[model samples]
Structure formats: structure tokens, C-alpha cells
Target: MCENAAVTSTDGQQSPPPAPVVPLTDAWLVIPLFNEAQVVRGVIEEARRVFPLVVAVDDGSRDDSAAQAAAGGAVVVRHPLNLGQGAALQTGITYVLERTDANFVVTFDADGQHSVADAAAMVQAARDEDLAFVLGSRFLQGPSPVGWLKRLVLKTAAVAASHTTGMHLTDAHNGLRVIRRDAAARLDLRQNRMAHASEIIRQLGATGLPWREFPVHIAYTDYSKGKGQSLWNSINILVDLLFS
Candidate 1:
């Protein structure tokens, strides 16, 4: 759970105690990395500023992503071979949940697109609301500057996920999220790639955990764009969902 961060006072009265600040010790920020050596260090350092406990799962990177993450003050977990993002996440989550005493877990992308500030806020919100999970949404404050084709593809995927899972999700594949230990324990992750995103939504909906999405801003730099999913991947995801 979250611990109160700061208190505020109003007109001659203190507002109902604000949400508690989540201690970094009690939360584990799980970053799934795959050859993101250039930015992974900075990302780890930045995340460490808000959450001290960071576990970077190096998914069999061909470069020094693991070393960079380790040097950046993260506990590095590695897969023997190159597994997909979901596998990397599972490796990290299982390690954190089983190895550490962390009460909560967060799945973040190593692509440097997710916001640490948004993640910190979500942790506080999760603790204050006693939610099982907090999902980040890019559409909460209106549309982001995403490309039209990307938007169409994502929306179509989101709609498919919503209908399949019976959950009204504005964004189903956002990588920023906070998952409490209890809820995380209930998850039976099977997918190993991008399809895992939809699998998570389905699991969350099936479990009926108290969950909500908060607005998060994603910075789409050249590096992230280069590593992002392609338009054709949407078709692949749909096919995988149906058959794989």
C-alpha cells in the first residue's frame, strides 16, 4: 500500500489527509529491457529518484543493457535466451514477488516512453483508493499526438480487447501500470509477446479487481518510434488472439 507523501491545509482546516506517499522499499518498479542500452541507464536513474527498488529484466539483450541497468542501481534479472516482453515481465514480476518483500509491482517499458511522475502518482492513487491495479491512459485528457494510422490501429485493438474482456478500457496496451501484490498474485500470464498486453486486460477484467486508468503522457522520441510496434503487428495480434 501507499504511505502518505505530504499533507495540505485549507481555509483554517486541514483537508482530509491526502494520499500517502508510497515508499520505494514497498514497491518494485519492473522495467523490461531488450537492447535499450542507450537510454536504459538514464531511465533507471530517473525511476530510482521516485522509487528506490527497481528490477530491470534484461530479455537476453545483445548489448550491455543488463550492465547498464545494474550500474544504474537496479537489480538485474536476465533471461538465458531472448524472450518476448511478456516473458521478460513475467521473469521480473516473479522475481520481485518471490524474492523481495515488495507489496506492489509496476510494469514499465524500458523504451523511455513511460513517465515516472505519472507512475508515482498512480502508486499513491492505488494506495489511497485501495485498488488492485492502476492503468495509465493516453486518452483521458483527449487524444495525444499519435499518428492517424497508429490511432486507428490502437483503437481497433482496444475495442477488440474491450469487447473480449467485457471491460471498458480507454487504452488497453499502455505499458505504465501499478499492480498490487494481491492482484498481481492472481495473474496467470501465458502470452509471451505483445499479445500479453491484451492477456493482462482480460485477466484483470476476469478477476474483477478494483481498477481505473489515469492520464499519462508518452514521449515518442526517435528511439522509441524505432522500437515501437508496427501497423502490421495489429493484424498479427488479432490473429494470435484468435488462434495462438
Candidate 2:
């Protein structure tokens, strides 16, 4: 549902119509924010155009990420100390479930890598198909434009996660997902780091609920690239997955 509104000025001049209001009020966006003060505000503001309810869980950022997120029309939840992405995600999810009546929850990255259109599509698909979960995959449509080494690591991780979770996935660490309210309530993410990616897949797979992977494009802009995870973090995730 979309609606455009216009207003008339005092001098009887018609003002330009505002952007169409998207009717995705039943879904809430959960953004795990750390030191993303530069881009988090823009991301939240853009996403709010479609999904009005957005909650940014600030994971003890040393910057003004919380303030920026609030300014962008998102409800900012702060963690006094850096608890990592997984913890932030869990906090956001819990907030949505406890404080709102949202039927769906969308986990979106705060670095502007995720597209709001894709997120909305995933939610619509889930509602149409009656699925409990809709996970994002970068390699579902074709090969993603990732570096050779990073591609290798991601593929290897996907294979390992598939074997462990018994869910065939092309991209194991994509951070865009839609979870129904009941499904979101069932999630209990304990891994407080990048390892939570694999853990989430495993837990969601264990739910035995209907789920599908949607192809999503990740924008690797100069700013996002600069804030991307480090090689050591990737290595640690692999190690955690292999052992845990």
C-alpha cells in the first residue's frame, strides 16, 4: 500500500507531493550498530521510508552512532559496553518483541550494505509463502563480486555450515534476514561475535520451519569497505565454527 499526500501553501500554491508512504507497518527493522556514526543515520532514514519501525541497538560505540540513529527516526537502544554484533542483535530483537506488536523482524546491517527494497521483498515473500524465516544469500543468483580470498572463505564456510546445520546455503554469513514474530522469539543467540552468523543458521535450521534464501545484493561502497570486518575476524569465525 502506498499513498502520496500534497499540501497547499497560504498563497494557494500547491506544494510538491511528498514521497509515497509504504505500508509495511507490521514489520520492524533491527539494526546492530557499533561505530557506524557516518552511515547508520542515512541507512535508518532510508529504510524508514518503507518500514516505519526501526530499532538500532548501539553496541557500546565510542562514537555518536546512537545519537545519529535516533535523529534518523529510529528508537536507539544503548549497551553500556561493547558486547559485539550478536549481542546487539539479540537486544534489538528482544526490544521489538517486548515493546512492539510487530509481526515480523528484519535484521539489517548498519553499514548501508543492505537494500531496503530487498528487505521488503523478503518480508513479502515470507508472508505470501507462510514461511517463518527468509535468509539472504549473495551467491543465490550467481557469483558475487567479492575478492578471491574472501569468496573462498565464504564458500568454505557455507559448505561447513550446511554440513553442520543440514541446510544447503550458498552464502552463510549474509546479515539480511526476515523472521516471523514466533520464529524470532525462538532465537537465542549466545555467540557474541561474528561466529553468531553460523550459529543463527544452525538454530534457525533446527526450528524445522519453512524457510528460503532470497538473492540480495550487498553494496561494497568505499565507506562500507573501510568498515568491513578484518581478516583476523574472518579467521576467528571460521575457527569458532569448526570447533563449536
Candidate 3:
């Protein structure tokens, strides 16, 4: 279960002395940025427009991604060294738990694939279902823009995970997800790189955390497309699954 579970309201009000926690109006948006100095600012700006408290984790970028995110109104947490995506996410999550009062934690990619509106929708959906985890799916509603081979790999992995976990999710690798603080606390992120996506599915399967998937926009811009994992990355992910 998530250790950070607490009701928060948008208004900065609490119940009483020894204060009752007003449902958190604050949601911690954790964006793990690598060398994405170009797009990080826009992502942070969009996040700020929706969620007042957005935390951008700079994973030892060589560029000004950290400073740019800070300038764009995100609370930036910089790692002394590049530990990888999982570590960056963990850093941001832990910061939110310690520094601010947040009712939920939502993870987004620094790449421009995710939309701020979709993110806010994910949070609303979480509130309605009271679920611990929710994943974003690009394939659920229509054709995905990714190349056919990539789509094939993604679909296969999702199907395999669904069969393995008995949870029929169409998209398991999507980075856009909302986690209840308690559920997040329970996740042990061992994978340092791309495999973290698969690791999350495995952990949720083992923990039986209530989970669901919602369709979200994944804008495959020229920049995002260029930075996307190679078809070989999917192969490596599969190898990791077999061995893991």
C-alpha cells in the first residue's frame, strides 16, 4: 500500500488543531528529465497550468534542463549523478513525500508525448475509482502512431502481462500513470533503465494493487520520435522479462 495516502483538498484548509488533513488539493507531478533541455520547459509549464505543485527531477543532465524546469515553475530536484529513469522518479516521489502535502503522485515523461490535460484527467479518474494505480494507453481507443513493429512489440508485451497477471490491460508500458501514495511506497524499483516499465507491471501483479488503464494522447512529435526507444530496446525488454 502507498505510505503517502492522505485526503487533500485544493483549498489550503485542514480540519482542526492537531489538524485534520483537508483532502489534498495538491498533487505532485513527478517528471524525470534526462538530456531533454529543449522540451522540458514546455512540459513543466503545461504541468504547472494544471497542477500547482509539479516537481521535475533532473537526472544529471549536462544541459540546463534543471534550471529551465525551475524557471518554468517546477520544483526541481537534481541528482548528483545519472542514476536512470527509475532513480529519478524515486527521487521526485520521495521529495514530494517529505517536502509537501500531496494527495497523489503522478509520473509523466519529460518527452513531449504526454499532455497536461490528459494528466489532469488521470487524476480525476483516480479520484473516482479510488484506485491505487492507473496506466495510460495509446492503443486502447484507436491505432497507435508508433511504427507497426514497435506497436507489435508493445501489444505482445501487454498481452503477455495481461495473461500473466490476469489483468486485461492493453497498455502496460505507458509511462503516464497516476499512483496513490501508498501504492507508490510499495513499489520497489530495481530496474534502472527502460526495463522499469516492465518492473512496475510485475510489482503490481505481485502486490495485487488495484489497477486500471485509461487512454491518453501520446503526441509523437519529430523530437519524441527521434528519442524513442529503438525496436531493439523492445527486444531487450523481452529478454529481461524472460530472465527476470
Candidate 4:
């Protein structure tokens, strides 16, 4: 028998070693908060059920967002002044990219809409497919908690993004996403407004990032409906899209 082969008796009996079980660890869950002290705790709590590292960025919230987030067991990053959502998220991403050994990171809303379980699943899906980016969609699979006008606006924006960026994404503004370190590093989010959603699509196209789409649940509460983006904001987003 060769040295590499296991020795066997004349009766042809042989033994096999046990396979190793690899532990699961890579992704970090990030929640961006702007005066969302009411819902941030639950969001972080749910996120910790899956990801060991949960980061909450307090975007200059006048409320107790930073304290509450830290109390809820999340690594808290705060801004002295109120920055936009894109900037807050980018800050959190950059912090983790520099400070941790994270391979993937998820950008999730601080509101009570997103499911942490779904976020974990999205990370798993990204790992399985080896995707650079995974976007969560509310329209592709089933029902959404968004209002009619909001749905219409999102759909219209999705179409515009498709034409503008040559990408076939179902929902362009969903806040839930899984991103690889390389793709996140390549992203340059200059927009300080809602138009960053569209800019992200453009960046994905520009960088040729391998991305996929997955369905997720969104629970649009009365509070979220009240706090939803306005049509005027959509027009502003359009201007940003056109000019920037």
C-alpha cells in the first residue's frame, strides 16, 4: 500500500476519519437610526439573535438613540450632527470594514419593519451563492406593508433605476441588503438624501458587482406610514439623480 493510503487488513477492512464542522461567522448586522429611539431596541435585539456583531449608527438623533442602542447590546456609533441615512450607513460600514474581520455586512432599517431572521437568511443566501451584493425585495415575492402611493413611487423608481443603470432589480429602495467587503469598499455614497438608493444601483452597475435579489417581509406600521418619505422628497431625489 502507498504511504498516502490507509493500511487495511487482509480482509479489506478500513477506517475513515471524521469530517470537521466549520463554524458560521462572517456577517455583521448594521442598523442606521435617525430619531428612531422607539423601535431601535427591538431591531437590535432581533438582529443579535443571528449575528454576533450588531452595530447601530445614531445619525445625530436628538433623542436617546445612542444610549438605547448601546443598552440593547449593539456596538453604537454616533454622529455629532444629523447626517443623511446614506452617510450614516456608510459610516457604520466603514467602521466595521476597518475594525472587524467581517467578510459581509448587512444594512438594515432601524424602524420595526425589517425582520432580523430574514436578514440572517439573506446573509446565508449570499454565502451560498458567493454574491457580492444581495438586495431584499418586497414586490418580487409577496405582500408589502407600504401604502399605495408609496408602492407606486417605489415601482416607478425601480423602473427608472433599471433604465438608468441597466440593472434588473425589483425594488431599488428597500433598506435591507447584504454586501461583501469588496463591494462595500468600492461603494462611494456621496448623496446625502434619499436618492442614494438610486445611486447604489448605479454604483453596482459601474463596479460590475455580482449581486442577487431575495424576498423579505416588511411590516409598515402606522408610525412608519406617518413617517414615510413625501412626494416632494421623491422630486428632490429625482433632481439628485439628474444632477448627481
- Per-residue CA lDDT of candidate 4, range 1-244, in tens? 5435565668998755333323336888778888988878877876676676888888999999898899889899989998898898889889889999899988888888887777878888888888899999998876776666667778888888889888897889888989889888888888768888887778877878688889999886776767754455556655665676
Q: Rank the candidates by lDDT, best first.
A: 2, 1, 4, 3
Q: Answer with 1 or 2, whichever has the higher TM-score.
A: 2
Q: Cα miss at 169, model 3 (Å)?
A: 1.6
Clashes of each: 5, 0, 13, 0
Best by TM-score: 2
- Each candidate: RMSD to true structure? 5.5, 5.6, 9.7, 9.5
Query: Residue 5 deviation, candidate 1, in Å?
Result: 20
TM-score of each: 0.86, 0.89, 0.84, 0.84
**Residue 80 of model 1, lDDT score:** 76
Against the true structure, candidate 3 has what lDDT?
0.80
User: Ten-residue segment with the worst summed lDDT in candidate 2?
Assistant: 224-233
lDDT by residue (1-244, candidate 1, tens digit) is 3344344556565455565444567899999988999999999898888798999999999999999999999999889798888888888889887998888899998878888889989988999999999999888897697777767667777898899978788888788989999888877778887788888888878888898889999888887668565455556665665675
Worst ten in a row by lDDT for model 3:
15-24
Local distance difference test, per candidate? Answer: 0.84, 0.90, 0.80, 0.81
